[model samples]
Target: MTAPEPTTDGTYRDRIIAVEPGGNEFIADADRHGRPSQLVWTWASPNLEFATIFLGVLAVAYYGMNFWQAAAGILLGAGLGVLAHGVLSARGPRHGVPQMVLGRLPFGFKGNAVPSTLMSITAGVGWFATNSVSGAFALSTLFGIGPLPALVVVVLIQTSLAFFGHNLVQAFERFAFPVLAVIFALASVAILGKSDLGAPAFEDGVGGLGGFLLTVGTTFGYVAGWAPYAADFSRYLPKTVSPVRTGFFAATGLFLACTTLAIVGAASVTIATDATDNPTDAFTSSLPEWLASATLLAIAIGAIAANAINVYSGAMAFVTTGIKLPAHIARALATVFFGVAGFLIAWWALADAAASYEAFLLLIAYWIGPWLGVVFADQYLRRGHRVEGFLYDRSYTNWPGLASFLIGLVVSVLLFCNQERFVGFVVRAVPELGDITFFVGFVLAAGCYLVFCRAKIEAERVAL
Candidate 1:
């Protein structure tokens, strides 16, 4: 198939592929306002969210947390994120717009830059670094290679994968997802013997409403990036696919998987007697696989499947932020950068830095507050669930969204720092405040934006 050529700019976005009139209700043509256009679902469809959801939970569970806590973290963290996903993903197939473009209706064309760039930094350097680091750890543990050498290997692998982009990524997933399930299930059940104590408890003795809330918020917050891009894959899929079906399945799968992984991690702590930070080694040492040759292969494949998506998504964000390069070249740079960064960061944690991990996840979760809240408020209040056209139009600039997001972002940063007087008092008084930061951020964004949007509507009505 002939790949679509760029029109004037070097970016694939440099050109338009197709437009349907009358039938097209979405905003697409720069020449025409409010009419929708189909984006080249060039990267496979948003259905790839299956991988996104899976990996999001697996990350916290496998890397920083154990199986039991993975369970708690996923359930608590992802619940709100899942609720928000419904609104975000459903509109994609209807209008055929990418999340960032759709965002312009709410954030304004200029304001939209914040999210596009935020996604890039969070997913780009942050996510890339994380996946690359995991791969490095796997390689170092499985082989005799040092962490730095393993880090180099990780960077090379991610860069190579990014070079292939969509097709190879798709193939990698088909194989990786199934293998991961089998391995996770085996390990989970194997460790179940440790928790023969009884039915599950909300308290791992890490207990409290505060910790639970924080764990849940952080868990879902990590992948809150998906909310903006959920429909990025679904847009290519015919509207017939049923948004409700996709959303439910994906959300449920994510929630359950995280719960399972957390349970397994906590269980492993007791069974394998592993105080080790990385949970992968616990599985290998306990299972027959460690002594066998397949350990390296399993770790490598899992890392590749996930790191591929991380790099791919990061590349998309980088391109969106104006890299002025072909998709392949852009993706290559992100993959390598993250790969090397992740490897090196791994060295920073030699012991169980549980306090540090909590602090980091909480800090990261702060971004989710403004982004998700603004998105939610944008779709529900300002637009009335109606897809806005001329999304790039200055008139379409929903100041409510802009103000709300900025205000929310600033508040979240302050609260996260704990030096701010009122916020500090709140966090100090309420042990559970850390767990619910997403709620604070989301509520602030939504409440503020909704009030402003309502006032704007009233002003327009009076003018008429």
Candidate 2:
């Protein structure tokens, strides 16, 4: 099957076979055919992988929640997080720009770099490393190879897929989904059937209102981290696609996959006598040899799926930061640069996976919460207005957005951050409040932006 060529009129479906290897410059139109339903598999497939499972283990092993309690937290937190994801995704077809680029509307062309740069690091380096370590460990377990060798293998595959760019990434996700679903479904049954669902909630005197709230926050962070990149995948769909349908499919896919697998992780902890020391091994150890090997392979593939998005979006974020380069070259180079940086971080993370993973999730929530609040607030203020002209408009800069975002971020971290690395003053004083950094940051940023910038935003819209 020959691949479709880029249209002379500049409207084309992304090539499934050819290397896309370009930044978001042109808007996709009706000629670029895709359904809202494809968003489901595109979002769901990568998340169905093992890193999500590790989230559940974090709740049960570290946060000290019981199987049932952790499950509830996972469901509630993931549902809320993915809802944001869906909303952001629906913007893709409307703008036909990368998520970070669309951020230019709210942040201004120059001010957009702040969030774009942060997202580039978080997605490309932070998440890339986090997911890579998990994939590397799975490879090591399967082949008895050293972690470094397995990591090299994992990074190579992930970067290559991302380097090929959008269409291939979408294709890979669609292809991987059914296989991942089946394997995880089987693994879930094997793990959950033997789990002690009624296990003590306070195994080491860790169960309390604080623990439960922490579990919810951590889970929310894990899932909500994807909000920034939500529109990257959906931008190729025709603009006429129903926003409601697009958001629904994306949210449903993410919520179901993350919740179900996370619950499986929680349940695995209850049954595994050795305890959840190494989440990767603990998860597979209970299954039969054939199933275990298959699960490990699925996890490695799943990591690739997830990392592909990370690398691609990281490149988009990098380019969106006012860097002037040929779109294809810039995106490809950014992919390699971030992939190398992520590999180094992955090497460091392997030394202390659990601690690093926990800290990473919390750290993500700290920044992303404020970022989301500002972005969503900006969207609501616009009321479905299109600002494609400002996407690349270097002269535009919204100081209010930047100021509001910083205010929200600072307030949230100072008051509600509750991580092992750094406990906030408020959390220290009132231990029961747990980590509400995400909630505080989001609300504060949105409120501040609305209060301080609404009139200005309205005037700008009228001018446009």
Candidate 3:
């Protein structure tokens, strides 16, 4: 495949207007053309939506944290999460492949299927449903419509965006950024003006050190969930783009968007009672009718923005797992199939948005923590090396990555997890530790992979 010729200004319009044809293929050098700074809006705009705001709300209302405490947790957790996200994003331009495709370097081509399959379900079905429910609820509130129909509307719009693929996704996000930023900014001002920042840290049996830890874990999970898809958007940047600059922009966008909105959500809780139960209503109830209506509309739009990434990356993950078909056809089919599935899940989740959302965020942490551990360890072991040769080499099967991931997942869930469904043994035995599963999983998986797989990975690199 020949790279498209660059315009005099160094921007390639064909890359943006053209529907990307290849599936999980390395981007040609000519096709790789865009400013690294575009990642700022590309990462930020979608996250500017309600799901992120709801996380802040979850911190205050559900975990019983006060505004200041919630803000602290959000800042710290989101800061750490986005740093990892930024580092991973730098890999995109260097490798010119989807994030999951690069997993083959660590997990082996066939073994990479394990994480790719899991990511497909998580992004396409799990997160898609989660955000769609929030959007549907916003529509229902704004129009007095039922959630099912609203969900259908949401699914159709986001799925279409994913069907068109990369350039459109980036364009849509860039277009949405300024509007979303202004609307959410207005909402934040209104919320902060009404909030009681000095409100007692613990109210109604909430806000202990344990609750604080839980809030941190939830916030980290919410932001870090984007880590697996980090490179998907960044791969289109020109190969010469500075990795540091690219990572900085991506991280800044994620950190700013998630932390700012989360703080808004937290502050909103101080003045709005029972906000956690129905976040859309709680958030909009305090605003004037016109602004409230506008905010609701923005939320629905935001869900579409977030889900565009989810569906697109999810489709990419599906294709990476050895699916055989034309890339465009596979992506289109995956978008439709997952859209329907997500709609059904969203419809069901609307019944208990607060509980369902909380569980979803924590569950995301459960798997993603271990996955990040393995991926980051592999990246470190490679030390800025490229892996073009390993991209399509299916014969290699790196059992170590798989074993490390499973071990970390199982051990972390069994011990440190503290959730609604089942408490881990350690958490049950000592309720004060909170949910430290993500931390435990990351450390364990990374340590295991380093000990067992690093030498083998280095040997393969030398052979290449």
User: Top model by TM-score, which number?
Assistant: 2
* Lowest lDDT block of 10, candidate 3: 1-10
* lDDT per residue as tens, model 3, 1-464: 11322122323334565555656777776677788899999989889889999888888877888888889988988987998899999988887788998898778878889989999999999999999988998998999898888899999999989887889999999999999999989988988898888887646634677778888899999999999899999988888999999999999999999999999888887784553445697788988898899899999989999999999999889988987876447777877788888888888898888888888899999888999999989988988564676677767688989999999999999999998789999999889888889999999999999999978877876776
Tens digits of per-residue lDDT, candidate 1, 220-256, equal: 6654645655554344344455666556554554444
Off by over 4 Å in 2: 1-12, 275-277
**Which model is ahead, 1 or 2, in terms of lDDT?**
2
Tens digit of lDDT per residue, candidate 2, span 51-163? Answer: 89988888887778888889888988898799899899888887777788878877887888899999999999999999999999899999989889999999999999898
lDDT of 2: 0.85
Provide the RMSD of all predictions against the true structure, rounded to 1 decimal: 7.7, 4.0, 3.4
Cα displacement (Å) at residue 8, model 3: 22
For model 3, state the Cα shift of residue 135 in Å: 0.9
Clash numbers, per candidate:
28, 0, 0
Candidate 3 lDDT at 223 equals 93
Number of the top lDDT candidate: 3
